[model samples]
Structures are given as C-alpha cells and as structure tokens.
Target chain A: MKNNILIAALLFAAFPLLSNTLVVCPDCPVNTIAKGIALANPCDTVLVQSGTYYENNIEINKDLTLIGEGMPVVDGKEQGEIFTVENKYFYIEGFRIQNVGRSYVEDRAGIRIRKSTQFTIRNNEFDEAFFAIYLQNSSKGLIEGNHISAHSLEEANSGNAIHAWYCSYLEIANNVVKGNRDGIYLEFVDNSLIHNNLSQDNIRYGLHFMFSDDDSYYDNEFVDNGAGVAVMYSKNIVMQRNVFRDNWGAASYGLLLKDIFDSEIFHNRFNQNTVGIFMETSNRLKIQQNEFSENGWAVKMSGGNQTNILSKNNFLHNTFNLSVHSAGTDNVFSSNYWSDYAGYDLDKDGVGDVPHRPMKLFSYVVSSTPEAMVLLRSLFIDLLNFSEKVSPIFTPENVIDETPLMTPLPVFGKV
Target chain B: MFKIFKYSFFDLIRSRWTYIYAGFYFLFTLGMLMLSSDLSKVVISSMNVVLILCPLIATMFGVMYYYNSREFTELLLSQPIKRTSIFTGQFLGLATSLSVSLLVGAGIPFLMFGVFGSDQAGNFLVLLFNGVVLSFIFAAISFFIALKNEDKIKGFGLAILVWLLLAVVYDGLLLLGLSWFRDYPLEKASLIASVLNPIDLSRVMLLLKLDISALMSLTGAVYRKFLGSGVGMAISVAVLLIWTIIPTLGIRRVCLRRDF
Candidate 1:
C-alpha cells in the first residue's frame, strides 16, 4: 500500500511537467480522438473540441486525460464500445457519449474502466448506451455528475446505467440515471460511497447490490422503478436519508433486503410503494427513524431474520402495517409510532400504555391466500381481524412495539 | 303525488324508529371516533357497518312501513289520487327518510371529529353516498316484494332473504367462482359479476379507493384499466343508478297491476 501511494504521488507530481496537450477536431491535424491518442505520448491531455465524432472501439493503453470542451458529442453510431481505459490515472470529463451498440455475447459500455485505478469519469451524458459506465476490477474511481439514460423496456435487452464489479473505494455521486435494467448495480464491490443520485424508471431495481460489502449509500432518491432497491447477500451496509417512492407493483417494494447482515438503514422515506421494506434471512439490521406512508404493506418479514432492531419509525396510513410469513422473529420493535395504534396512555406519558401489535390476521391470510386480497376492507375480513386481535391467534404473538409513541415521530427533513 | 310525498315524508320523519335509527348511527359513529384516533380507519369501519346494516335495516323498515300503512293506503285508494301516485309517494317518503337518517347520523359524528379538515373527507363522503344509494335500492326492492305478496309474513321473509342474497351470498359465490377459475383470466368476469350485485358493486367502488394495492395485484389488464381510470368510476356509478331505477320501476309497475 505504501509503495502504491508513493508511486501515485510520484506520478501525480511528474504528470504536469511531462504531459503535452493535443487538440482534436473535425478540421484539426489530429481529427479523431483515436488519432489524437495514437499521436500523443503517455500522461498527455487530449483536448477534443466541439464536433460530432462518429467513432467507436477507442482504447487507451497509457495514462492520459481526455477532456471535451463545449460538450463534444461522441456518437458511437451503433458500432461498439466507445472508450476502454486499461491504464491507471486517467480522467474523462465533459462529453456526450451515445448509442453504444447492443450485443448478446459481449458486455459493451460507453465508458469501461478495466483493471485501472485512480480514474475520474465526470460531467458526461450518456444516451441510449447499453451500459453507460462500467468498472471491472477498478479501484479509487470517481464517477460524478453524469446523466445516463436508456429506452429499455425489458431487462434481458438492457444493461445498467452504472455497473461496478470487483471494484473498491469508488465515489459515485450527483448522477441522474433512468430507464435502464438498473440505475446502479454493484457486484462484489466493497468500501464505496454512493450519494446524492437520482435513479428512476428502470426496468428492474433502481439500485441493486449483490455480494457487495461495506458500502454506504446516502441521500439518494429512487422512484417509480420496477423495484426501488435490493441489497442481497451483503454485510455492513449503511443506508441513510434516501427517498424511495412510487414503486408500485405486485412484486415490487421500496427496499428489499435478502440475506443482508449488520446493516444500518435510517432516516429514509418510503412512500406509496406496494411493499415498503421486505426482509428475508437478514440479520442484525438497525432500521430507525424512517417514515413509511401509504404503502400497501409497510414492513414484511420472512423467515430466518434475527436480531433486527426497528426503532423510532413512523408508519402512517399503510394498508397493512406488518406482514410476517415466519412464525416468530427474534427482532426488537420499540418506540415506533403506528397510526393504527388504538392503545391509550393512561399515565399521561407520550407513549401508549399498552403494547401495539403491528401484524394483522388478514395480512397472514393474504400471505397464504393471496386472492383473498380482494376481500380487503370487507366486513367479514374486518370481523376476522378483530376476533384475531381480541385473541392471540393466526398472527405471531411476539411482533409488538412495547413503547408505541402516541404521535407520529417527526421525519428527518422537517425536523 | 308531490303533496302525498310531503305528507308521507313528514309522517314517517316523526315516527319513533326514525329517531331511533338515526340515534343509533350517531352514537355508534361517535363511539368509534372516540375509541380510535385514526379517522381513516374509522371511516373504513363505518363503511363496513353502512354496507351491511344499511341494507338489512332498509329491508325490514320497508316491509314494516308498507304493512303498517295499509289502512292509510286504502283510505288514499278511495280518494281521487291515482294508485301509482299513492305507492310512489310512500316509497319515496320511506326511502328519503331512511337516507336522511343515515346521512345525518354518520355525517354529524364525522363533522364533529374534524373529518372535513382532513384528507379523509372524500372517503367519508363516498361512504355516505354509498349508504344512501343502498338504502334507496333495498327499500325499492322490498316495496316491490310487499306489493307482490299479500301475506305479510311471506313478504317480510322474502325481503330479508333478498337482503341476505345480495349482501352475503352473492359475494360468497363470486369468491367461489373466482377461485374455481383461478387458472383462467377472471378479471372481466369478476367485474361483471360485481356489477350484477349492488352490494358487491358498492364494495368494489370503495375498494378501488381504499385498498388499491391489493386490487392491483390481480394481473388483469382490463380490470386495471377499468378501475384505474375515471371511465370505470363513471361506469360503476351508472350501474348503481340503473340498479336503483330498475327496482323503483318494478315497484311502480307492481303497484299499478295489484288489486287491493
């Protein structure tokens, strides 16, 4: 690590003195970006001026900076991969890259970083690209302020907007991504920070991570995707202050956690989703101070979830507060404010005197007989739920908030 | 017809049952509101009560009023008033008085609970509107049944039976059919079946607003399009209007044909 830092420091110091500038335009001596790269030496800066460059399969093997002035357009013309960076210490900024060709055999992208470190891809707009920005085994990269979109209607035919695989220490922020298979997907990626991004209208999950650990994502907005976000088989993930909204479908949810461990999800807002938070086999999760409103089901817990603490959240006007498929969960739910709580505070405390149970018998019935959902809000169903509430039957007995707040907890932003 | 309608309306409005029915609803709604702080939930609970109790009460009240007012009807029949006029006036009077009791009973508690200041006001209004419509529909049907049967016991039994069929049995059969045909696309069939039963139709109308997530889970394109659009709401309302008109027209026709 010390040697790597020393080398980076030396290279950083030597870059300004040794680097030369090469201008590329339609009428310039080096007309194309590929030609400019070919003519320039290592550590040089290629300034591509405003022009439509119809090129593809551009490969950079050395450390270089490709800066586009006036937002030059690089139309791949449905050919292939646009920029393939294989060496360390490169920067790509201020370009509009579009129309990377779709391929069934190869995973193509507009900007691909392969085994490269200390790169910055920022201020670029990608339109109709199969994969807007893809990082493979690349570390210490910064992808910021890019607008990425595609017109993909199916998951099989599309790629993610930003896909990181086997990467670490990446900072991805201030990006807007939409209408791809997934807005951002990470696999085997660790120790990354993703914040201040807006991801919406994707064919699949807005932000999806699988087998990725030690990642933190905060202040991001995910809306109207097939499923808002999914964190699967991951550990030690910190999710804070994000907004998940309008993700409505039978199988969709605001956030899905499967096999996740030791994660912290706090201060998020889940609004109008079919299911707000779905957990399966997730353990030791701390979920606090979130606001869930107008969802079909606020929180659904399946089997194998243990030691999860749900604290101080406000659940407002959801159809079913909690639906648990498991017989019991070793989870602690305390101090949450439930709008459906009917208990009184006789002692004049702010909290209710009686413990409030969020799980309902009708939710368990719906879990087993999904078609019975049509009978929701019916008199018979109401009677069933009332009887079940009067007597502890059908629903799990342990899933109760001991200290239910009488009033809704103040949300993050308003406070 | 107008003068007779006014007299009958005032006569029933002063009756003991009207105050009792209205008072029952007022007290129930007030208790529900006081017990539960969630106004939306109270609205839902009231909806169920309105959906079930409204029809049952309307049926019993319709039969009782028609039977008890037989002397008044015979006295009116001896006058120069038309047969259709007398029956239609009494039917309208009974329907309007029951509806007024329902509206005032439910509305006063909701208003007292500050429901008008909340977003749930719309849902509450729909619930009351549905209650009024159900009252009219069940009363008209019971009036027609009483007109057909001279025996008071038979007419009352048949009226209650009709209520039972629509309120509970129809939904049971609908659910059975849906499950039996679970493999097939049952969206259009389910919607049509619901439209056939006035009770189911009203329940679905409420469900469209209250539990849309659960409704949308049934993967039927036509069902989604119909319920998700304004056109579907218009169609459901039209169907309900047609339901009320048909039973009322039947009452008129039976009254004109029957011999006292």
Candidate 2:
C-alpha cells in the first residue's frame, strides 16, 4: 500500500509536466469556455482570459484546471446551469459567474459538482445565482474565498449560496454570502467545516443543516438575516466563536437547534437577536462560555429537550434570559452569569448564595399566551415576577442555575 | 380665572413637595445616566419610573392640594368669580405644576447627557410626553374625585384607589383576559383595552418605541404595525386627551352643583 501511494504521488507530480495550457478569449481560436474545455485533455489547464462570456451548461468531465485571468465574467443570461463538473480532480478559480435562471422544477447552480472527489473551487464570485456552488455526493472538496450574493424575495423562489447534498469531508471557508435564501445549506452532509464566513441579509437562515452530522462551524458572522443558523436532525456538531447579531423579526432566532443530539456550542456571541438560541427536542448538548447580550430571549428551550448542560455563559441584559416551555429534569444549568441575577454573593466564592432562576413568570405567561408580552416592563408584571421568584410557581421549577456567577464571565475574546 | 390659575401655579411651584418630587427625579435620572452610558437604556429605565410615579404623584398631589386649600377655595367661591373658572383654573394650575416638575426633574439629567444629540432623543421625548399626559389625566381625575367626595379620608382613599386601579390592577386584568381568551384573536381587543386606560396607553406607546426589538414577535408585529405608525400615535394622543377632558368636565359638573 505504501509503494502504491508513492507511485500515485509520483504520477500526479509528472502528470502536470505533460499537461498543456489552452487559452480561451474573444480573439482566440478557442473562444468559448465550452470550446476550451472540449479541446483540453485530462490534467490539462484551460486559461480563460478576462472577457464577458455569455455561456451556460459548460460541462467538465476531465481532470483539469480552469483558471480565469483578471476575474472574467461568465454570464449565464438566466439560461441554465454553468460549469457542471462530473469527474474527479477538478479545480476552478477566479471567475465571476452570474444569472443562472430560476426554475420551479430544476435546481440550477453556477457551479454544480456531482459524484466528484478531490475538487477545489476557490476565489469565485457569484451574483443572482439560484444555487451558487452546489455539491452532490462529492468528497474531499474545498470551497473557499467565494463571494455569493442573490436578491432572494421569498423562500419558495430563492436558493442557497453554498448547498451541499449527501457530501462528506468538505471545507467551506472565508466566504461572504448575502441576500440569499440561505447562506450555506447542508442536507445529508457529514464531516464538514464552515468557518470565517459572513452571511447577512439572507431571506432565510444564514446557515441551514438537515440530517448532517459531525460538522463544525466557527468564526462566522450571521447578521440581519431572517434567522441566523439552524441545525435540525443533526448530531455531534461543534459550533464555536460565531457571532449572531441583529436577526430581528417575528420568528427570527440566532441559532435554532431541533432534534439535535450531543452537540457542543461554545464561545458564540448572540447579540440583539429576537430569540438567541432556540432549542427544540435537542438532547445531551453542551453549551458553555457563550455570550448572550441584548437578545429578546437569551435561550428559549421548547419541550423534549433533555440532559443539556449549559454552563459558564454570560447572559447580559436580554429582555428575557430564558423561556423554558417544559423543563427536563436532567438538564443542568450551572455557573452562568446572569445580568438580571439579583442574588447576593456571600462568602466571596464568586458564585451567588441563592440559586438563580433564569425563567421568569412573565416569560412563562408569554410562552403560554404570546399576547401577554404586551405587558412587558409593566409594574404589575414586575410584581408578579418578583412574587413568583420568591416562590417557584408558574415558571418551571427545574430550570435554575445552581451556581450563578456574580459577574459576567470574560469568555469571548472579541465580537 | 387666569389670576387664580397664576396664584395656584406659583403656590405649588414654591411648595417643598414639588421641589422634592423634581429633585428625586433629577437625582434618579442623573444616577441612571451615570450608571449606564447607553442613553436608550436610560430612557427605558426612566420610562418605567415615569409610568408608575407620574400618575401616582399627580393623583396624591391633586387630592392633597384640593383638600388642604378647601377653606381658601370657599373664600374664593364667596367672591364674584365664576365657579367654573375657579375649578378649571385650579385643575389647570395643578396639572401644569405637576408637568413642570416632571419636565424639569427628568429633562435636566437628559440634557446634561446631551439626549437631544443622541439617537434616543425621540424615545426620551416620548417618555416626557407620556409623563406629562399622565400627569394631566390623573390630576384631573383626582380633582374630580376630591370635588365629589366631601370627606377627606374618602377623597384620598378614592384617589389612591383610582391610581392603583389604573396603574396595576388594569394590567393584571388585561393579562388575565388575554390568557383566558387566548384561543380567540385578542389583538384588537387588547389594543382597545389598553387605549381605554390612559396609563396603559402611555405604557404601550412608550414601550413600542423602547422595546420594539423585543416586541417584533408574532403578535407584536400587529402591535408594531399599529402603534409604530402615525395613526396609532394620533389615536393614543386623542385617547389621552379624552381621558383628561372627561375628568375635567366631571370636576366642572361637580363644582357647579356642589353645596360647598
């Protein structure tokens, strides 16, 4: 196996030497990208010069490198898919692809990779694309430094910027996505890493996951989207150092987890979202060291969430710190700093002597009857909450932080 | 009437209670401003104080002033002055003095913080406007209650009751009603109910401006659409005006017919 691996590496090193470079420009003999790809062989390079190419359905079936000089424009004219790759060892970079047409039946994309392995799509710009960079059943691929944007009016008509379906071992990093239906979408995808991406003003979630597992996302900013990031039916996900900000709307949330199990969420900053981190039916999750400031509700836990350990988080000045619909017995909340925790810290141990109950009676009332939220900040409701805090009655009894921090934890580095 | 109004206004302005009220607000606002640098947050905290304190203080002061100056009011009644003008002048004087106390008390600290230059200027102005309106409404209501009740204990008891009812009990009942009839659409019902109560009206109006982000929820969208608009402002202001006018009219009706 060692000899075979050495021979494969040696063949890859020699293959580039035998490859030829094909140029595609307006004045060249090979003018169109389709013509350039058709003339190129395996392990060859197609160098597309800077010019407007009104092309669509450019298929790549060989192991080739397509490099665009000076960021050439590939306008699909709202026609169909562009640069559909079906083979392995493919690489494309530095092209501005735009205007892939929308269809109710077909999922048209700027670059669609299907059943391909060891591919790299880097430094690309996509505008008005229905689906910007789509991967299906592809493995060991890198999607980096791509700027994807679309004016998505509604959920039905718009598509995602980076969509991965049934894919594995993908690295999506340093991309900026805005105004799309979803910034990044993963369905049935596993073992992926998404980082350093800024997704804002999307019509739907910034990042959406469905049935994906073992994926980690960090250092991403999701701002002013319909919602921030949503992970559903996923397991073993690690989300860290992401900033979810200003996602304000009727149903907007910073991070939404549904039916997710064994996930670790830490060091994230949730600021000014309507609902910061909304969890439903998620179990055994470890949430620690996150900072939640000025959100509507710092964390809203719906029914069926169990065994979740939330510790060392800073809940700073959110209107409602926590709203638990039905408290699970095994869920543990410890050592979290609550700005509204009015308990005294005696003995100077850095923890409050009294247990901090994050769930307020008004939040309980609001969860049951949403219209009662209009009474927020009223003197009557303050009295009611105070009385309820003195004795656990309306709000769930189990949703209490046993060791509440006296001051906000210095968890996040910078936001 | 103008002479009486001027006398009462100056008399209350010189009173130590008025100075104490204004001083309390000034110190509280200044302390809040010093505590937090966020002007919007300061405005929100002041909003709660204004909503609760303005009406209560106005109610207490109105009943106390009317009861304390009863002999002087009788001497004025023995003069050639019209009764309507006398009561109307007293009511106007009391409301204006209370409003001045609120404006000076809350306005100075905000001005020291340069609230006019900040983005929270609009919310601050709304806070002051709601406080002033509540003062007028509650003062008029209490004045009318004092005129109707001959007994001092009963008048003070009734005025405090009115304040308690509007400030606290109304919201409790509204919440109970909202939660009870949650199956039905209570948006219009709740809006109308809040509009009917001047305190709730002021609270809702100020809340829509301050906590708009938190209120931008499912039902809050409906509220934001209504209360965040010019029409809603006009309606709330009109309701507050009606709240003030009805009580003043009741005071006038009692002043003309009362045996005192």
Candidate 3:
C-alpha cells in the first residue's frame, strides 16, 4: 500500500511536464529550430512564426504536424534541401520556402518524400529552389493546394516543380504550379488521380507524363507552357474534361502523343495551339465528345497510328480539319462534325450525303516536305487535292468518314 | 622563366584537398548515373553543375594564389627579369594546374560508357572548353589583379562580382529588358545579348549539340538555325576565342605596363 501511493504521487507530478506545442520566437531560449524539433514527439505541433529562418538540409522523419503560423518561412540558408520528409502519416502545411541549393548530383527539393505513406503537404509556397516537391520511391501521398514558383538560370540548371518518379497511388489536386522546368512531371507513376490543378507558363510542359499508366487526369488547365503536355509510352490511361489551351510554339501542341495505346480521351478541349492533337505511332484510342477549335491543325495524325476511333467529336474553325501523313484505312472517323464540311443533308436527319475523305493529298506532301506548307491555300494545291479525291489515287480509298454529323454537339469551351 | 613556372607549380602543390574534391566529384557523377533511371538527365545535370562550380573554383583559386604569392612574386620581381614573363609563367602554371587536375578528376567516371555515356563523353569536350575557358578567364583576371592590387580580398571581391554579374544577375537584367521593351522581338535580341558573356555561349553551344533547339528558337533561334550549321558553329568558336584572347591580351598589356 505504501509503494502504490508513492507511484501515484510520481504520476501526478509528471502531468504538467509534458507539453504538446513548440513555439519558435527570436527571444526563445533555443536558437536552432531543428534542435527544438528533435526534442518533440510524434503528436506535437511545431508552430513557427513569421521570420526568415536560415537552416539547411532539414529531415522531417516523424508523424508530426509542422504548422507555420503567420507566414513563417524556412530558408535553406542558401545551402540545400530545406525539408526532406521520409515519414509515414504526417502533415506539413502553411510555410513559405526559398533558396534551395542546386546540386546536379542529388534530387534535392523543398520537400522530398521517400518510401512514405498517407502524407499530406498543402498550402505552401516555394521559390528559386531546384524542385518544389519531389516524390520518389514512395506511395499513397496527397499533395494539394501548394503554390510553387522557381527561377532557373539555364534549362540544364533547373529542376521540376513537382516531380513523381517510380511512385504510385498519388492524389494531386488543386495546386498552382508556375515558372519551373515543368509544372508537374510524372514518370513511371501509376494509379494516380490528378484533378483541378492550374499549371501554366513553365519553361517546359505544364504536365509531362511519360510511361505513367493506369492514371486518370480530369479538370486541369494547362496553359501557355513551352509545350502543353507530352503523353508518351503509356497504356490504360483516361484523360477527361481537361482544358489544353493557349500553349503555342513553333513545334508545340495541345497534346503530343507518341507510342501511346489503349487510352480514353473524353470531353476535353484542345484550343489555340500550334496543333490540337498530334499523334504518332499511337493506336486504339477512343476519342469521344471532345472539342477541337481555333488550332492550326485540328488533328495531325502521322502514318504510324492505327485502329483508333474518332467518334462524337466537334472540330470547329481549325485551319486544316484533319492533316494525315498517310491514308491509314479502317481508322473509323465517324460521327464527328467538321465546320468545313459542305455536303448536303437531304435526308433531313442532319447527316451529310457524301462521305468525308479527311486525308488530303496536300497534307501528305506537307508532311513529307514541311516547306510545302508555304504552298498551302494556293489554287494548284487545291486542284491537285480535288483530283486526287475524285479517283483516290494518292490517298487510301477506304479512309473516309461514311456519315459526317451535320451539327456540332453542345459540349464546348474549356470543359 | 622555367624556374618561375616550376616554383609556382610547387608553391600550391599542397592542395591535396583538390584530390579529395576530385574523388568526391567522380564518385558523385558515377553515383548519380547509377541511381538515375534516366542516364541522359544525369549527364545533362552534371554538366550544369560542372560549368558553374568549376568556373567558380578556378576563379577563386587563381585569385587566392595571386594574393598568397605576394612574397614569392616579390622575390621573382627582385630578379633582373621582365614582368611579362613572370605573369605569363604564372598564368600558364595556374591554367595547367587547374585544367589538368579537373580533366583527370571529371573524366574518370566516363571511362566505362554507361547509358548515354558516349554523348556524355562527347560533351566532355565542351566541359573541357568550359574548364579551359574558365581557367583562362580567371588567369587573365588574376594577372590584372596581381598587377593592380596588393590586397587579396579586393581582387576576390572584384572577380566574384564579375562572375555573379555575368552568369546570375545578367538574366535578371534580360528579364528587365523583356518587361521594358514589350513590343520588340527582345527574345531575338537576347540571342545577341548572350554573346556578351561566354558562359551563356558555352551553355548554348552544348545545348545545340544535344539537338533540341527549342530554347534557342525563341531568342537566337533564327541566328543559330541559319548559321548554326557549319559556318555558324565556326563563328561561335570564334566568339569563344574572342572571350579568351581579348581578356588575356588586356592582362598582357597591363603586365607590360606595370612596374612590379
């Protein structure tokens, strides 16, 4: 009975000793923020106030909430790697960051996650760092509501804004990425949902997904990038209701598809780019209910594409309707409204009488010799295209839209 | 004299720290390529750091050596020799020390051609140019400082300011130009603007060798595409030469004029 009373007294004494909050102030006892964090437990919250703290290479390796109050900023001190989070089930939110070192040897970031799970990073800002948020060799992460900007002196010197490599099960939503090498980049990522992001004006593509398969991206706007988006070497992808607009360059496009297969591109807008949709060696894509307008070329399909479906789409006011490198047959160009379609709808069902042969001979010649684009809109090229269309000598005979839609579908404008 | 070169060489021979640094860099380059799934990105990235750090190190070393060699320089000047010969010897000695050591250090990783290793090795030629030009640029600057000032910190400050202004701050100025002159094809003007600094030129030429000229397309795309062929490449080489020779000759003239 005496020993039990002593143990109860000890427990009572320790009640007021444990504190769950960390406060960062200039007049505080400790000067090193990292040292203070080291003394904290997993459930503690680190509340840093507004001051430009100069610290370098911080590793966040616990399940704690790092909350910045009143715009507290953590500088890399112009040294390197501001915060590296390799912890599971953590939340890092509400800070401003700047001046991460540029090391070509390592994949450094304002926040780098490795082999972690169920993490959330939101409501932060980063500037002049190599990469804003770097996700590598990790899974099941949520990156949302971060505004990131970067300044790269040279392209070779710059890194991506948000980069995912060899990672899966990501939920990236509602972020604004601007002025980095690429706004958002993914390579070999899978099972991800990218939605509601505004990525624009980056040095390269706004969103670059290469070999990232089984992912779905919807309701994102990619505008005024060096290139819009480069989708290459992937399968089982679904791109729906996204807006690819205003990304213009000499060789830029709304989407550059190379070696892609078995994807569904639905209800997207391709607007005001050099080429609306450029495809090469892509096959078996179901392009449905999409709108292509005011682009240089509505669809520039090279010779290597096969077994694709162009159904229930609208092509309005593009300079050239559909430019093909080869007259690939049985590609199924049906139920799409072409604004330039001039055939009569005599049956009163709003369908054209003549089948539309989209592959003009001049488009093929233009593909072979790009300099012949200068000869476009000329009388000789028109006569040549018409003569070839009448007998179908140069273009494939069966590559035609059997029944063209007379009226465009109501789906339009940045869907 | 050969004695001066020999003495200068032996003077800073205790920089075994350079050996350790070289080993670290070699390991870094190789380790980066191995860890990276995209090997070309590693090389491209390594090239970027190589240019920036290499030039800074060369420049810093030259400035530090000139300052530290006060007594040594005084001893050589006490002899009945011309000041130009001493400066030339120092310049050659500095260039040889930094260039040869960097080549051996940076070249060892690419001895085995990993993925994109051949292109990387091809780009080693450019790296070599960067190292050579950087060393020469510093050597010329070192000579001017070695002639002009007796203080080391002042010379270092001048050199640092110059490199910073040329590489880092110049882009900000270009950005300012873009904002100021919104109507003109200022990007096209930027191509000519890059000619003002050789560091930018080296980066441009190396990127051109990579064959994705979209970056140049905005600024000097017309100039690079039109003359970037044979004659254009040759002219770029000439421009690189101008960056080196003009500065070196100015140092040579200063060495002739100064009564060290």
Residue pairs with backbone atoms closer than 3 Å in model 2 (clashes): none
Each prediction's whole-model lDDT (CA): 0.89, 0.92, 0.75
Per-residue CA lDDT of model 3 for A228-306, tens digit only, reads 7788899888888889998776667788888899999999998887788889999999998899987777788887899
Worst 10 residues of 3 chain A by lDDT: A371-380
* Tens-place lDDT digits, model 2, residues B124-215: 98899999999999999999999999999999999999999999999999999999999998878888888899988887787778766354
Model 2: which docking level applies? medium
Model 2 misplacement above 4 A: A1-17, B211-216
C-alpha RMSD in Å of predicted model 3 compared with the true structure:
25.4
lDDT per residue (tens digit) for residues A219-280 in model 2? 99999998899999999999999999999877899999999999999899999999999999
Q: Provide all candidates' interface root-mean-square deviations.
A: 3.1, 1.7, 16.6
Candidate 1's TM-score: 0.82
What does the lDDT read for residue A235 in candidate 2?
100
lDDT: the better of candidates 1 and 3: 1
DockQ of 3: 0.01
lDDT of 1 by residue, A1-415 (tens): 9999999999999887788999999999889999999988998999999999999999999999999999999999988899998987789999999999788888899999999889999999999999999999999999999999999988888999999999999999999999999999999999999999999999899999999999999999999998899999999999999999999876788999999999999999999998999999999999999999989999988889999999999999888988888876789999999999989999888999999889888788667656556666666566667888788676788888899999998877643
The TM-scores of all predictions, comma-separated, are 0.82, 0.95, 0.59
Tens digits of per-residue lDDT for model 3, B110-208: 554453345455666776676677667756665566557666678788878777776566654654464466566554565666556667666666655
Per-candidate clashes, comma-separated: 0, 0, 1
lDDT for A333 (candidate 3): 88
